[model samples]
Target: MSLITCSKGHQNPEGSRFCTLCGEPLPEHNAFAGGINTGLVEGTRLRDRYMIKYQLGQGGFGRTYLAEDTGRFNELIVLKELMPTGQGTYALQKAEELFQREAAILHKLRHPQIPKFWELFRDRKGLFLVQDYIEGKTYQDLLNNRLDNGQSFSEVEIIELLQQLLPVLSYLHKQGVIHRDISPDNVIRKEQDGLPILIDFGGVKQTAIDVATQLAAEKYGGSGTRLGKSGYAPDEQLRLGSVAPHSDLYALGVTAIVLMTGKPPQELFDAHTMSWVWNRQLNLSSDFNKILQRMLAQRPSERFQSAEEILQQLPAVSTVPETRVQPHLTQRQITSSNNNFIPPSPAPINTSGQGHLLDNSVEVPDEIVGWNWGAFLLPGFWCLTNRVWIGLLSWLDLSVVTLGIPTITISILLGLKGNEWAWKSRKWKSVKAFKRHQRFWAIAAFILWALFLIIIIGVILFAIAIAGFGM
Candidate 1:
């Protein structure tokens, strides 16, 4: 068989059953008629180093093969075979060049949560990417297993998973790398040495490249829209082409929904109504539900600003120990790290119903909700003292000063209170309780503001009535 090359540079047997380089089976060839004709033989040596062992798995982009590393004294390894394609061979070559560029970025990341790449090799056949072989069950596999059992994980369990996964994202974001494709299929959880290790770093994106430039080109080609699983992708990543750290968080949120519900995200979504079904079906904890909603927000801006932001914002698992929690989770830590732009700390966890462990007495007041007598008093004194110096109030000035001044005062007071209680105080026994306290004050402030608006409207209506009656 003369080494007949396809347009993609894949060599095959003279009358082969498939494009041996890629497992593109020869047209009309039976699936069982295979006997490693042209590809690397089971015992064959590559570059007089790594030895091919057996085939593992094959996909559109590449094929994974189990092999032996001779340089490492025949250490077991996995080879990812990158195939050549015809439709965009020139484009694919360019893509591979781009892929290698990104691969260099990933090679520098050293985290136990990330998969390790061994080496990249090329020969007369094609390009091959060799990485460490991690044996474990993928999140997808876990979902399938639970589905088979007609059961799903509890909300607490799902949040615990998120706690572990979010940290991996935080580390990546800190390094300026984004895992654009964060579907369950891509996240593998292996129990190695009694610890769960995250595997697969194939879809990482670097901050160096112009995301818009590449994104615009691949919007219709599954490079953007189809990069994730259908239901689990964020609305922005799926529809608006916004890819950021939040995009990963959105996928994780979707995965959490699936994990808790034991169904794929599409099943939980009502296309006609354009709403999720989990809320209707499950009686979920308000705290966990809120976190999920934030993660799945349709707008990127409305979502967490960064992976660290998401980590900081995620309410700690009610049942998990604080030490297992990430440091970025408390609002104070996030604000402190941000220099002067500090957000108030989260409220204490309410251990009511399932929150029995939470203690409200020790919880911090929401800095945004607590009373700031100083702000109100100072502003009132300034206005009263200066009234004689200023002229009579115009209609516009009255409206502005009447409504705007109070609104501004309330906002400042709440901000100050939130800052004091949530961030500054470590008096609370549990950070979870502090988180709950913050939520309570936030809701209370909102209700109070709404009532103030109602009262103002009532007074305006009364004034109009008096004027009309007099006239």
Candidate 2:
């Protein structure tokens, strides 16, 4: 049988519509007959260089195609077209503008985890953007495959994934860009290095919003447009049309939770209480849980202020030395002496009981049950030490909103209650050590308070001297 090579390098029989191995479509034999005059088809070459292999995917705004750059040793690339479906002249114009914007944005971005822009041009077929093709499956596909095998991502794997991906998010944020859509479907794990590459920029959504607003003003004399995936996007991005770096963090948190439990955000979130219920189903370390809670906070202000902050909170997983252990002693018992040690292999989860999935043999500390005086005294320090990033952000937000007037009171309250939250969320060597740490922070808080008072008195006396001179 005659053979054909799919864009993904899968070989299939000639006349086959799809590759048997990867399920990618094969280019039609006569696709290039009409050339640019008949739209993008198999074998059709653009700019006398890129050869269209087959269509990859399509949406309302445009279509993505798998193509080969013939001028560059037939290197695989993705070709994006700005062909708005069923839209009038105005909508088409807006799409073209956004397409240019996406190209510009991609051109300026220089991250290993982001696709590199190759070229942007218009031909008889219409506008097209060429970018490096990522050879990998989307996170959604990975999640689905794992679910099909009755396996879900472990806490450690999720943490590692976050560590690998957050830097990319930080890079984007530093460049003054907000990836408004950060769902599992938009992240691809590269086959070469298993590194997650973020795809699908939603800045075009801004153009869509403009088009919708214009249409609304022409019809009902109003303005508004809805953008973002449900459950993944925060309230501000969905309702108020406001997006920030934290908005992407919220979606990232949702993605992590979904990977952990293999459940959709809609199913995990409880609308009645406005909280996520997935915690009840999964056995996660307190610190990890706290980080996720902050990431998925209802208010953007309560979420991690930046990706770097979340990275600070993530527990470092050390590589355990490979050593044969006596059958009598379990891995937990062997590592009991080392407080920072994490077992190379995680114990299987026991779903038969109400307790955590953690092994019973392991003596993990329980979360604190009551108020934390140290937190009330030094909220910022306590949060920094305990890795409760949301608490720290909350303190900062309160200070800013209150114009620093309520700072002392807020600090006092945080000191009173911070230890409880911190202890519950953090892992320490022992209760005694945790208490000692809190006490140290409390002393620091006292010094901070003293400095604050000194500053206030200095300002007051200076003002008094100025008034006396005026008299």
Candidate 1 C-alpha lDDT tens digits along 430-469: 4455456555545654666679989999999999999999
Q: Model 2, which residues run further than 4 Å from truth?
A: 1-39, 85-90, 205-209, 212-220, 318-471
What's the CA error at residue 30 for candidate 1, in Å? 18
Each prediction's RMSD to truth: 22.3, 17.7
List TM-scores for all candidates, in order.
0.54, 0.59
Residue range with the least summed lDDT across 10 consecutive positions in model 1: 386-395
Which pairs in model 2 have colliding backbones?
Answer: 372-416, 372-419, 373-415, 375-414, 375-415, 376-414, 376-415, 376-416, 377-415
